[model samples]
Target: MSEAAVPDGRAAPTLTARQPKAVHSALTVLEAVARLGAGASAQDISRELGLPRATTYRLLNLLVQDEYLVRTPDLAGFALGAKVVQLATVAAPPARLASAARGVVAETRAALRGGVHVVFFAGGRLTVVDADPDFPLSDAVRLVREPERFAIGRLLLIDRGAADAAAVRDFAEFGATRQLGELAPAYGCVAVPILDGAGGFAGARGFSGSRPRADDPSDVLTVLRPAAARLGPLVV
Candidate 1:
């Protein structure tokens, strides 16, 4: 075999690549905190991330200061913070629904100046996977943990004549139907079902604006349906 000429007429030297400090440090800290989940102590983080104890403390302190992680009341352990919750609510993958629906949520928020929420059915409950700034109405609708009083979750179930059914059933119907809407005295919302590549329902994406503004469900549906349509195929 003929020997190949090296680039610039010189043989390439075997050398180890240098890791970028910022990127490496950030990733190391992130992995450490994630492995710790809701029970990570500073020492635990140091061991998990394989960094010096002082370095780990510095990184953890920075993360806590920035709201990426929160210390427990006793200050012995740490858990993910609200900012992380907010980010995860809008950026979770594997499920991939949040990422797929983010654009639609942004657009809806811009148009209505109200909250946009993406809800998912999990473990017999509806979880607010994502919520825009307009959410948790200040003077109007009071936020509740359960779905019964929430406009988005209730409408997703009841509007389809499946109010009494299981959450999974309602979600299934929602995915198959592609669109749903309802009017409430306090607030109103429009929802569209997202489906994956295999044509299975993934989740519900919707916009919650002022009740008076969303007076007509069809009007909101017009805006919401198209956005969901754009996202549905990309959920997988």
Candidate 2:
């Protein structure tokens, strides 16, 4: 309000809020799309973000052109694109592989809508490095008692023997599924291994959502494979 403080004799403009409207809008749009996950249409994003139809299409188009999002095969929906996954490559390095995977785990949960966990062997004890607070393993007690039933426990035993390794190798390479009793009688998981730069087993990453009978194995693998691959280099 002080004229003396004004650069050109006009009273200084008052700041009403933090961050520019465009920048804020873009971020909200991005977040909405991320939560909506793959196969979400522009209409879904527009509704979720309370954005105008025109603005939604504009943002979607821009994101697609920039590769932050990709049009589904039918060209009727959107999914996370390469540019989005590349962010994991630059995730800040942490003291251990688990710590480094924290951020990527959050992204995985949002994309898969399930309990996303990252575990690594540290100091001879297998530890959970990062997990989505929103999606805890359906039955933690049962999971501990029965490791062979779920993907997490099975993947962890991957080093048991050459025969066991061979049996699970294909599963880990392409993502493996877990039955109810192996994890939880109500839910299951699809997991893949995380390898270090030396090609050693670094950790495992996966999602536990609906039961296998409820969700397609291929769909779960589609999300987990890329996520595990993306976190591989960063953790290694």
Candidate 3:
């Protein structure tokens, strides 16, 4: 919270600050649920985004009412609602590419020790096209909230030339490795870039996993690289 000066010299809360922040948190809650993929419970959203349980439920119910989210038949989880899909379709570049790579993405996710995700940049924001429903590593909320903190997000940032000097140097040295406790503290992640048919930067594919020991840095290249190679030529 920031403070502003009043005539009485006492600190006053900035006007309308809390409202926008709440709005941001509500949106982040949605992203976290999306990343959690299939069978995500309300508790899962709360934990991932560090939001209060009451707040999480409020946001979830609101989105559900607005049709931005849909509850599962068994009432065990949540998925993107029809209205959300309708909105995404408006400029959803990754839709086709995301669909085509599903098989490979699943295969890659299975081959690895954790959940995998396919991300693309659209409308100046990152979107998670797909995630391993059975084993989501990190919540999507983190990816959307502070993208520069993760491997895939950093890759996208660097590509757009939006990264700062320190970030670039750090990426060069560390590559795309977001160790557990660093970002989610409960999971680790690694990413590889995907090129479009023209061989330019198109998107990113990566996986989240259990935090590895110091000797390892959540390396997924052996599996992710091949997946990207198999997927790159097809996205066009």
Index of the highest-TM-score prediction: 3
Q: Best-fitting candidate, measured by lDDT? A: 3
Which parts of model 1 have CA positions greater than 4 angstroms off? 1-101, 137-145, 155-186, 197-200
The TM-score measured for candidate 2 stands at: 0.49
Residue 157 miss distance in model 1 (angstroms): 3.8
- What is the per-residue lDDT of model 2 for residues 1-236, given as tens digits with 9 covering 90 to 100? 22235656676655455436765776677667667755679899999988899999997898878866667544777766545544532343333455556667667778777678776633322345564445544433223334455566566666443225533754655556455433235566676778778766677786776686324567777777788888988876
In the range 76-167, model 3's lDDT, one tens digit per residue, is 77766645544554455546444667778878877885767777766667776665555542434456657876777877787778876755
Which sections of candidate 2 miss by over 4 Å?
1-100, 122-124, 139-146, 162-173, 181-183, 213-215
My TM-score estimates for the predictions, one after another, are: 0.43, 0.49, 0.58
Report the lDDT of model 1 for residue 36: 53
Whole-model lDDT, candidate 3?
A: 0.68
Where is the poorest 10-residue window by lDDT in model 3? Answer: 210-219
Rank all candidate structures by their TM-score, best first, as comma-separated numbers.
3, 2, 1
Query: lDDT of each model, Cα atoms only?
Result: 0.54, 0.62, 0.68
* N/CA/C clash count, model 2: 2
